[model samples]
Target: MVFKCPFTMDCAGSVTSSCLVAEPLRSTGGREMLRVHFTAEDLTRIRIRAHPHPLWEVLLSLHLLQTRRGAAIFGPWRRDVRAALHPSGDILTTLAPPKGYSPDFLTPFVDSPELDDGLEVVLSTSSATLRADMTRLAEQTKLPSWAWRIAGGDAEMMRRLADRIRQYHAQALLPYAHVFKSHIREDWARRAEMAMTHGLEHVLSTLHPSIRWRAPVLEVDYPVDQDLSLDGRGLVLVPSFFCWQTSMTFADPALRPVLVYPVDPVIGWASHASATPDARSLEALLGRTRATVLRVIAEKPYLNTKQLARATGTTPSGASQHAAVLRDAGLVNTQRRNNSVVHSLSKRGAMLLDKPALQDRAGYPDIRLSNPSAG
Candidate 1:
């Protein structure tokens, strides 16, 4: 059965199309592109999320980590979180598709923008939405026994699922709350600056190296033949710290469209080797200034020499020299972006932070990662 488009007024006579799927991309040169055909309304509605959406992040984490794509970017987070999650990790894995679709109801956008409020709203998902979402999910995957039980709208099942999400958040994400929020705020600031200074087109064009802003359509690289006709319903662009490699969109064409893209350099859970002696983390190991450079790179992950210099209050040459040292030590990784190079932390660098020898006293070894939808 075809579900009516949510934006019936704007997307007149629109119906969900089979072609609306976002196929996975081989992503050569970080170049998987999705050509999002945006209408004028979408342009007006184009805005950055003020805060991270809980459902999106939680659910996306499950999907990415399960697929092992998360290992590269989320090396530190994954290693640390896994030990804490235990049996909950197994339960969480069921809800998210390692590679395909998830039901829309599982990640309902809460009425409020706040994470707590949103999670509460998620807990209170309407029966109609749950049935619809679960039914859809059922169509795609051979869901486990637990999912079949929840499809009946059982209160006990629902409560258990919600509890798992709460537990998962506390275990996996809470520890990084401050750093994650800080990175998001920084991203929002940079986006706002770009929007104000460079115009919306630049904002789209520079969204990621893989994304290309061609007039009327935002092209994303992917492996299969797929297309998303936004019609007039504006899209929600959600930046995610855990979303790796590929940008994800909602599978159900009937729901409000969303694009969950990875936040650059958002993961650097590891410590870097500093020029300073025997210090555990990059900052302490490298001395204040050098560590600041690594931190800056982690916050922005994938910056050119000039951008790095400006952010770290160092000359481009100085940033270049420090980056080289970090790279030689296998702490930082660099990629070529045309004439310039982009720098970020290597998986090895993130692991350095995870080691007991370089452990931070305050960092929590709490919570295993879980997927709420799995239950």
Candidate 2:
């Protein structure tokens, strides 16, 4: 069986079609794909991460920094991160090479999506696991003496590696969290809505062009021929901002099953400095605070008064007032969920954020946030 993309690649190796990234379509034949076998019970068990996984982002973004594969998309962010990197960033780049095996211990599962939790897990990696993973990595690429110490489960080496990972995350990933994370949140919202309205099957089938749902199996574009049996453990679909071109799974099948797939590609959102310009433009139209409120709502829909206030750095009453004004203007919708008022962007509001020009074209009402009496 063969899978083909409808788009053609241009001289720059970019897809002419707006729908997909180039790599998946670059070579359709003789490409390896992962076939995930699922049982009926497993179907019910499939889940999606609510937010970006910090360690996963750390690993994948490091991969991007070392390679020029997705320059069209990751170029700006790469340049910015490189400028901000400490000399210690080399430790990460060395551990996670661009085109080969990376020690699985670098990205261990954390109970929560928080970076601190993930870092704790990394620091606590079992001695046997570290030696085994480093041994596997050694087979493919040369490791430095420091890396060998890590394999030996030397505490100081392990701590140094964790510290470097933390530094890289803070330098490269944290600053741009709003842009990429907002995109991931949007992806999650869409997936959740699809699951609720159509069914889980629809969500899986439409995940990406490179991933297809065929009855009991999910075929994914991958670097190697592999099969994962869900055997009722279910699978977590993690939408990643730094993961480019294709979806990937754990090299060690014994770990919990996960599919880290790239989210929908939006060119402007890919840049590290994009959020500032976009926010500035919106601030020019909407007052700074109100615009921030709208963006926060868009990122995490169904935010309650308290959560919204916390996110936007405003008081609860202030958040309520802004939400009320947006609600009155038909730009936001409010509903009672679990006895708390939650806010989300209405269709018109989403359109405005997605295409700023649409507000002019649609002739949305002039919203004045300067009025002291108005929210």
lDDT of 1 at 298: 53
Candidate 2 CA-lDDT value:
0.70
Quantify how close model 1 is to the true structure by its C-alpha RMSD in Å.
17.4
The models' CA-based lDDT, in order, is 0.60, 0.70
| C-alpha TM-scores of all predictions | 0.62, 0.67
lDDT of 1 by residue, 276-298 (tens): 22233333467655655665555
lDDT of 1: 0.60
Model 2 over residues 101-177: C-alpha lDDT tens digits? Answer: 67778877664665657878888889999998888777757788988899989999877777677556655765466
Best by TM-score: 2
The runs of at least 3 residues in candidate 2 whose Cα sits more than 4 Å from the true structure, single-residue gaps closed, are 1-30, 270-375
For model 1 the local lDDT of residue 92 reads: 65
Span of ten consecutive residues with least summed lDDT in model 1: 1-10
Backbone clashes (count) for model 1: 20
